[model samples]
Target: MSSLDAEPHAPGADAPRSPGPLLAIESSCDETAAAVIAADRSVLSSVVSSQAALHERFGGVVPEIASRAHVERILPVIREALAEANVTPTDLSAIAVVTHPGLVGSLLVGVTAAKTLAAVWDLPLIAVDHLRAHLYACRIAYGEEAFPACGLVVSGGHTNWYDCPDAVRATLIGSTIDDAAGEAFDKVARLLGLPYPGGPSVQQAAEHGDPTAVPLPRPMMNRPELAVSFSGLKTAVRYAALGNPNSPEVPAPPLGERRIADLAASFQAAAVDVLVGKCDLALKQTGRPTLLVGGGVAANRALRVGLTDLCERRGVRLCIAPMELCVDNAAMAGLAWESFERGEFAPLDCDVTPGLVRA
Candidate 1:
């Protein structure tokens, strides 16, 4: 039986009883997070311990360091989540954890912690795909009304198009054939002397800049495939910033408020333009009337504005997770509700699948 079929008694005819509340864990990357959500899909409490400061000095996240950080924060984060929700192990009917498609060591910490909790409390266990959870993160942020639409996930780790039927199932349509969009952002940001986590830094700098100032090529723009490629753009941006004579790419020397903002604006424009074009193609191909965007890079204000504008002009409804949920959080574990109803408990055999999916 599904959680939807488990709701309590109705007025006249008996309604289904709701499955018990769920405790969800997420350690897919640098964040150690936990959440308690009810069968009705209400998030009771959510806690996230971020390791951005730990990784900032390195220019990017080191997988091993991220894993260690998860270990340090997992227990405390969960305890905080439970306390904030005013729930105990005895109150939770199931436990759900993200177990795949992320940094291997990082994923293990979450899977191990979740498995231990399930065993000690004798509760059902669920495994959630990290990327899928990103999509569900939208449902949590926008409510169920935001589900069942085609979604475009763009972040440092991924960029893809999906035919989302619901929270648990998504049909992949388009994805990057080379470096992910977020990876490109970081590379470009580094070249520009922007801080780590390039997406935001680049976006901030781009606000006042003229995107037209940099005549960067839009790779795969007219391509027959729906795939995206940002490696060339990143390279172009780098050559421009360094004033490499061999490279045709050119840019005003990085300086002054206006110049910095214009470059930032240009870079952001190029990235978002490609993203929006692909989304337009996806909508045309799938014929889906709604569009949803999520993941860490989804928090980019410029990207959001561009996507929203394209969606509006194309007559497609747009849905995005709130800025807080757009990054990483445990509230996205749809498996919580799934496990509660099906009682599909994981055995001791449960283990993390780091390479859960390529894109």
Candidate 2:
């Protein structure tokens, strides 16, 4: 049992005399994070403990390693969040946690911690969807003006778009049928002998290279459907970086720094082209006034430039989360406040939804 179980659940016994901030926790994947947000949606503190180095040897995030790290770092992260916000648990109104569309064990860690704190403090508990939080990050950055927009979330595990009608509710309109764009980035990076956390590494490499030097495929970019595919693109990158074994010229040449840079630029361009095409198609189909982009891949400079140019041409206002809020973090838990406003709290027995949310 948690040591917190020993605390009594007195509804108003230790309640603050005034309304205060909400404690939000996020352990959806490799990052264990926490934040304190005020009643006015101001983030007082946000702390994230990353397990990137721990998973670097594996070239990708391992679920088991991620969950175990969460178990060890969650408390310290939360304590830091609270301290930085200059608030104690007794001064909070409620607690929130991401409980869906993430690694099951990682989600459970945050949920269990949030639930324990909520019970011990006699405060309400809120459940936030991971994807929904990503979308809400745009809202937090741009205020109410960012809503009723088309939201695209591009992370290592998710590549999906939503028809967002409001703050708390959004309908999935499209998604990846095969590998996510970010996943393609990671696998392609490995093919090039690039570092882990492929998105940033690839982006950095692409800077000194020519994006047109590679003939990578832009899978499904020509299709009218909103769904996308990146597996073929990744395979094309593999062939370009490493000679195909079926060919007699397999020993043509090894990947040099210049060649790696060129390949990275080409792969990034192809991926961003498909993404930009989809965004253009989504706007044409939905006619939404705003385009809101979030998630880790949304932090890509190429993507940001592509999206900015697309919005300008289409006369669509672009709203994006600040770079700090682009990655998975507790501060993006802005959706929880929307739920709290509607009194749509979750039950204490709520469980995590472990799979990617299908459109």
Return the top candidate by TM-score: 2
lDDT of each: 0.79, 0.88
- How far does residue 107 in candidate 1 sit from its true spot (Å)? 0.6
Candidate 1, RMSD to the unseen true structure: 5.7
* Superposed model 2: Cα runs more than 4 Å off: 1-18, 250-252
Candidate 1 lDDT for residue 186 = 81
TM-score of each: 0.90, 0.95
Q: How many backbone clashes does candidate 2 have?
A: 0
lDDT of 1 by residue, 1-359 (tens): 32212333223534555566788999988889999988877899989998988987787889999999999889889888888998777667788998888898998999998887777676668888878878877777677777578888887788988998776668889998787888887877777678888888888777768989877778897776789988887776766666667744654475666756666677778888888888888888888777888888889887888888988899988988778778788988854575555656667667888763743
Q: How many angstroms is residue 359 displaced in model 2 relative to the true structure, after the best TM-score fit?
A: 7.4
C-alpha positional error of residue 353 in candidate 2 after TM-score superposition, expressed in Å:
0.4
Predicted structure with the largest lDDT when compared to the true one: 2
Q: Ten consecutive residues with minimal summed lDDT in candidate 2? A: 1-10
Error of 1 at 68 (Å): 0.9
